[model samples]
Target: MPPSTISRVINATNGRDGELVTSQQCIDHIRTQRVNNIGHECISIIRHFQSMTANDKFGLPFAPFTGVNHHRQSTLLGCALLADEQEDTFVWLFKEWLKCMHGIEPDAIITDQDRAMCNAIHSVFPTTRHRYCYWHMQKHIIDHLPTLVSRYGEQFQRYWGLWCNSSSIEQCEGYWVEMKEKFDINEEGDGWLQTVYKCREHWVPCYLKDSFFAGMRSSQRSESINAFFDGYVNSQTQLHEFVTQYKKVVTHRRLSEAHEDFKSLNTKSVMLLGHPIEIQAGEMYTRNMFDVFHTEFKGFGTEFCEELRKDIVEYKVCKFTDRGKWEVVTYE
Candidate 1:
């Protein structure tokens, strides 16, 4: 890949009519390429490659404008090369992609704490809930507050646990105050934390407990897609090669998902415990999900009915090596 050739390739791919195809265009291409051999199942698999977007060149301030399908188990949605991370650019890209998908709005979107991206999301999907990536937030803490972790490792761990597990706004506020007092993080010294606290509703789990985030609390899905591309393409990878390599990755992922679906449909998982809930779960959920449900269900035996009222029940949940906790709930 010579410099001149690379420049030409980049220009073509980022140009008005790039070599990269949209989701529908890819499906149509696959159908046309193998019209006689491909079936409806194959077409459905092709549809899973819903979106893909590339960012700007390698050394730009903002990375490429990449988006992935959060709905289809971390599948590549679409990628496009953007001039900048402006609100208008994001709005145009989002609208174009939405039109391709027949204007279906997502329930929730998780991304890094970028003001431009947040503004664009709000403008395009007014009703959709926007969440900050927990992983990114933690990384930011590590990157900026290294001394806090280095000097007070145990305290940092405890604070992080409280912050992540707080169930209510009051609890979150209380824990945050305790954490700040314990660490002596004043407004002047820890401005990042103070700034982040203002937007706690978007990032903190306490406020997002009821939102439908589909278990994605981070941009790990997009990160994973980027990792997949690393093996096939690199900084020097030409635009044409990227398009070809992307299709290959999509094909591999589709095959892997299809195999998993087949196994999930045909196989049954053994129950960890003989609880009625476990039995019901095995019948209702896929094997992978049943495993997760089984682990949570095993803790049920630790909870005992401490008190009972006419319409409310109080359960005493014992934590391993910790004090017993009581929770009051309505009983049907």
Candidate 2:
């Protein structure tokens, strides 16, 4: 039998000692018996880093991971060991984590619109800009107002496009007013729109366009991390099994990233647009990023100037279609 199976049997049989049956007992056994030296090693590493002169200006940076769901009965997944999704708990976690890092805070954080999480973030990292996950926001809008999408499909698409792509606060405000009037959202007493509007600073791109968010407008990366972990371990995984599996997962991920990096450094991407700009981008960017740039570069040729004013220029940008339908917009 595998070591994991043997360990599971031992845990189930109270380990022949009759003291490691409960979740707490299992946790204590793992912490004290297995990883006690590892915990001490981590503290020693932290202390060594702190003592180094080169590290004086830089603090130990870490990312927050929350809402990790696992089976309640599993020893490794129990609430007593893992942090709960509560405001006070989150605040305490942040405080304890920050204490080790010498008070350095993250510039921005992207999360779902959980009131407790948002409140905890604000309380602990007051200066950090909190952004709502765009994917989550869109899902909420669709889920809450299914009729809007079903009945006014075209109008909703237009509204969504305008809301996402608006470059400035003025433009967003103008588009929002038009959207509300055309949809009769205000007159219909749409509570969802009202609530979202009240927290516009957290989600609206116009308000956050100038903030340095490292180009992140969603918590999709965090979700992807969770998904990666799901491939290695499930809810029923024991504490020791989880630790062993986690190391394997991390090793696999690191190897994959290293492979991608080697490929990026060694290989050259084929130019799509055959333009000088595209050639430059192909040299500078990774294969995936060059593809995105090539797509945008191709669209630039399709746009034409319709009208030019002293302060504003009107451009008709063509959509990707055989028919010559264009979107006209004024830029000042």
Highest lDDT, which number?
A: 1
Candidate 1 achieves a global lDDT of: 0.70
Off by over 4 Å in 2: 1-81, 96-102, 146-167, 174-191, 212-216, 272-276, 301-332
Cα deviation of 187 in candidate 2 (Å)?
A: 12
Error of 1 at 35 (Å): 58
**Alpha-carbon local distance difference test for all models:** 0.70, 0.67
* Model 2 lDDT per residue over 189-233, tens place: 666667887798898888997687644667776666666667876
Q: Name the lDDT of candidate 2.
A: 0.67
TM-scores for candidates 1 onward, in order: 0.64, 0.58
| lDDT measured at residue 57 in model 2 versus the true structure, 0 to 100 | 20
Error of 1 at 21 (Å): 52
